[model samples]
Target: MVVDLQARLRDALAGSDVDELVELGCDLADAGRQEQALACFQRAVDLGQDWIWFNVANTLRELDRPTEAVTAYQRAIAAGQSDAWLNLAHVLDSLGDLAGAMEAYRAAGQAGGQPEGHVQLAHLLHQQGEPQRAQAALAPALQRGYLPAVALAARWRWENTRESADPVLEQQLRAGAGVDGSARADLAELLIATGRREQAREQLQLGAKLGQRECWLPLGNLLAGDDLSAEPGQEQEVDGAEVDKAGAEEAYRAGIAAGDEWCHHNLALLLLQRGDVRAAEEHLLAGAAAGDELAQLAWQDLHQQD
Candidate 1:
């Protein structure tokens, strides 16, 4: 089906102007013909469609040709596509040019000043050890009601300032999570940090049901015998019950079906414990291909043992 679609796109591109070529290139890229898409985008660029540089750069990035992507992205900015600078930051970051990426993100922030852009800028700033600036950057985004920004701000407060999340912030997150499923994962994190494991588990389950890919890992962790509660201000043994293996297995499979890489790693561990070595290896390979470092280590260990 994809092959036929690509062939049709090629036929269309044969007589296409710059705009038509870009459209066809977009279709090809969406269809997973990354190299063909780059070719079409390059043809548009050759025709002096400077605006098409952004399309060419995106396709190049997808093809793992980041150097060419950087050049094309620069051309895009030169052509007055200021928004291309935001995407350029991503490519630069992938190329390990953190300084360049930060500058590009700053440029993007100055131009658009959107919540999402500020959030990205803040994260990079935080990573660069500029916590003060990061906090300042997050203020606008948090006030804009960007759910992720709220969670990030809470995390910054908890981690950097050695302070607990303020009650108002907690309440705000809880209210947002109640109506917006996407916010549930972040709410669960806050709840977990505050020793409200039961509430956190409930939020995680709801998040998973809502199809949040990241919710599965923490949910799986909670299901894997981490549900014990300690008495306040004491180290005491709370009885740990065996987890429901079947339910966990189901959750793992659901996450795998959703294309979550971490799920493959978690599911592989369960399969290995159950002596299903072959299936465990299969999942480990999938996870490794998806760039899970732990999965790659596990796969190597298995081969070494053999």
Candidate 2:
């Protein structure tokens, strides 16, 4: 129906206005008609509108043609659309053009790009062995109240300030907990490392209540009596007291709803232990789709008979 309406509009108006064409392109894109969307965007581009170039680049990227996306993005930049540079940098990174990606990221920052672009630029700089520059890049994001940057800056400061689990570190972590979910998760981890299982459980429960979904996995495991060992075959110093499975299931379901991929894997294991193979398989497939390695392995094993 959208395609037919687009055809009627094109015939009625003779496709003069670039905005109308772009709107139609967006509608087609939303409807998953990529080929038609691409055509509309290209027609707008041929009519020499700068902003339409971004749409063309996005469609190219969605079609898995990142090379063409790079060209379109560059053209968009030339046509006074500097905001497309960050997306161009992402495509460049995927194609292993790190030097180009770094340059584009810097250009994006100069163009008043989003804080996330600065975060990615800092990460790339860090990976390239430029720690000081990476820290410098993160400064702007921290000032802008980017939570991940705030958490990362807190951690870096903590690393430089203390060598072990000290009262100061605990205080700082707790202070940052209200600002970053990672801070809460880190506090829980520090408690666990110090053999404070009861404190860790409380911290994790608080973290979950504060919307830290990743906390649920550990919370669920703590409820289910599973040892949070560093590795398989390692002895855990935790007490062997088990809580109710009902609570564990509740935590796992909360994590799954909050988009934690590994929660599906953990919940599937719990379901399987309770002899619900069909339900377990359903969750295993969901986790696999979300890129959980353990879930992929479990899914392969479960389907080996088929």
Candidate 2: the clashing residue pairs are none
Candidate 2 — what's its lDDT? 0.79
* Top model number, lDDT: 2
Q: lDDT for model 1, on a 0 to 1 scale?
A: 0.75
Q: What is the lDDT of every predicted structure here?
A: 0.75, 0.79
Query: lDDT per residue, candidate 1, 74-179, as tens digits?
Result: 9998998888888898888888898898788777767746466777889998888898998888788777788767767655554544333568766656655644
**In model 2, which runs have C-alpha deviations exceeding 4 angstroms?**
12-14, 155-184, 190-213, 224-306
**Which candidate number maximizes TM-score?**
1
lDDT of 2 by residue, 266-289 (tens): 788778766688998999999999
* C-alpha RMSD for every candidate: 6.5, 6.3
Error of 1 at 89 (Å): 0.7
